[model samples]
Target: MGEFLMDKVDLDDVLDKFGVFDRYHAVSGIFLVLGMAWNAMWYFNFIFVTEKVEYRCADHLLPNNTSANASTTLWCANPAVCSEWVYDNPDSFVAEFQLACQEWKRTLIGGVQSFGLMLGSFIIGALSDRFGRKTLIVITGVTGAALGLAKSFSTSYWLYFALEFLEAGFGDVTSPLFTLAVEMVATKSRVTYATICNVGFSGGLLVVLIAWLVPYWRHFQRVLYAPGLLFIVYIHVIDESPRWLLSQGKKEEAVHIIRKAANQNKLNIEENLIDMISCEKDEGLSFFTVLGNTLKSKSLLKRFIVCSVCLIACTFASHGLIINSVSLSGNKYTNFALSFGLKLPSSILSGYIIAKFNRRSPLILFFMACAALCIGQPFIPKSKYLLWLLILTYMAGKLTASMCLNTALIYTFELFPTKTRSSMHALCLAISKIGSITATQTPLMMAYWSGLPTAMFGGVALVAGLATLLVPDTGNKNLPNTVCEAEALEYSDRIKK
Candidate 1:
């Protein structure tokens, strides 16, 4: 009986018996993806709303009698030509605020958002682990929606900037939502759910592309807010993660949810099946305890360092390439759309690669591919054909970076135990946000030399790719539910070696 109990006493077996990808799983997965799509709208909305449209100095600044040609010549002569501005698009923040020559301020808008994301990752990460995943989702979701609406009505750049920061803090819900999604599903289905969430995120980019038809930034911003309303419905339909429930000693609630899931899939679970629902009785394990344990474990610490480095490199290269692509010799809308569209296929491919191969190879391969492209981008000669070539190369680099990002999402989710999953996920994202903050400065780096930022992106990615070898591959393995289980897996591997 002890042997039989041991054979059937894991989360994976329980999930298998419960119907891993059943009707309930399908419904929950759909809602999770939609939630992800809503988060993505605000995350990428800045790209569209703050887009640099064509502008020139206001006519009054040119001179009273200035001909169009003389006005143009005089405008070129004035260093402070942005005293007043006429923009091709009357609604963009850049045009309204006369930010033509003040490119750094424009960059700040995105930079501040990234900063908020960084802050949110740490704050909300801890809060989610403490309060529960669903609670934080509702809190952050409502707050993010409110701020996004308020930001649309800002009367000044500073007001908009302040709101952007707050909205980002509230709006960066993807990491926690990701943790929730992974925990809700079966172990074998984690990658599929994560990739589906990514697909929804890419769908948010598509929503932005479609919203571009609205023709005014404020109107576009308002449209972005419309999706957040769906969160209200989410409050009614979504279930809290049962794994998280079990971990918190809410066994009754966990069993109820699992039975409901089984019923939704048309399976009648045995009444005594709850007896097999085994988990470590970690009633008071807090984030600090996990951190203390992690700090003491050489393997855990090494895994943290390697994973963090990989995340930083991927974030820097990906965001820098996408943000800098606006300066390339193509229509900004087309470039942005194409760049964002590439994520769809890359996300699908990432799911397949993770399912079929070890996690380390894909990260190493994609990061190195991106590095090669970034390093080669600056060497291409300036010509009409070559310009397109460079753009395609850059797009390929972005695609590879997307794959790295998708892999990292699953890799990190699987790397840690359930007790510390949310916090560790948040920490990884916070590190990536720092990399994003750095990527925001790519424009500043470009001023010194256009190739400099790409070179930096390449160098970091190369180091990250090589460093990936140090982290263990977690493909096709049961996820750890406690720190001891996580460490045991690592130690057992070492013992075999």
Candidate 2:
């Protein structure tokens, strides 16, 4: 009787009967998927506004003997000092602040936003796991939207930077929303669900369109962030995750959601069986205790460490490639768009490969392919004929790296258990911040050697890929809800409590 209390016993068992893709799931999914896309853009929207733009000293004299002011259309990158500057994109943060010589400050913009994301995920994600994903999602969602919208009106760069930090640290919903999105679907569709959430012309690609449609930074931000204001209404619309309810020992709430879902799906659930659900909340285990258990297990701990290495490498490669894409010989806007825009296809292919094949093999192959292309990029001769080759090779690197990054994300989701899944995912993301921060300085690395950043991306990716063999494969496995279940992931390591 204790073991058969509906979801408390086995959520998948109940979810199987309730119907994973019924009307209830479909309605809830639309809101959650959109939520995922919205959350994706806010983190990197700074990329478009702070992108490197054409600028030259504003105090200089033009060839016609006319003094250059902010309105001067002519530009030159002379190696001379000046008090003022002219930027091609007057609305860009780079242009508005005259960061022509103070390039480090411009780079700091990305660093600050990445830091906010890292800190927010580590701190707020834990809070969500403890309280509830739904509550935290609404609070963070509203707060994030407000801060981001306020940033559009800021005149001072420092004020803008502060707003960026505040918005990201308080508003990051990826971790919570990610778990929620995946949990709403069944295990068989988890990969497909993850793929669609990102590949559906999500944040990176959308920003390109938004930036093109409204080239000015302030106005663009207003247009981009205003829709996020609707997140406040999610409190009434989005349902609390059923798995989270069961984990917290809220049997009644879980039953309620299940019953509602069943009725919506036109399925019949035995009310008497639901009434028989009598059990404690997994003995009221604290999050730390369960997490500690995973760390204690030799199998789980080994996997965690290896997964961290892979994630760090993935972020480094992904960020470095996209940030450096604009410098390639082509239209800057087109290059930037292709850098992320092409992920739509690569994501679909990666999802299929990882699903049809095993997770480990495709990861190894993708990372190796990306590493080879990136490492070879600098060797391409600088010439009109080979410029196409250079861009093609670079874009290829971006494509494979994107695929590898996606694989790393889904792989991490499978390796951990539900007891501390979000917490663990947040930790991995937080740990990977080192790569993101380092990636910001890639543009600066070109001074020492044009190929230094590219080579660096390849080297790290190479090592991470080779190391993937050390971690166990989790293809076509059920989502584990306990440390014991996670330890039993591989048959050889399975232990009976």
Using TM-score as the measure, the top candidate is 1
> Which residue ranges in model 1 land beyond 4 Å of their true spot?
2-8, 18-21, 59-83, 281-286, 495-497
Error of 2 at 70 (Å): 19
Each prediction's TM-score versus the true structure: 0.92, 0.89
lDDT per residue as tens, model 2, 293-379: 767888887887888888888889888888888787777779888887767888899999998986988999999998999999999
| Residue-level error in angstroms, candidate 2, position 137 | 2.0
Q: Could you give candidate 1's per-residue lDDT for residues 332-423 as a string of tens digits?
A: 77787788778789999988888788687888998899889888888888788678788888888889888888898788778888888888
By summed lDDT, the worst window of 10 consecutive residues in model 1 runs over 61-70
Local distance difference test, candidate 2: 0.79
Native-to-model Cα distance after best TM-score fit, residue 309 in candidate 1, in Å: 1.1
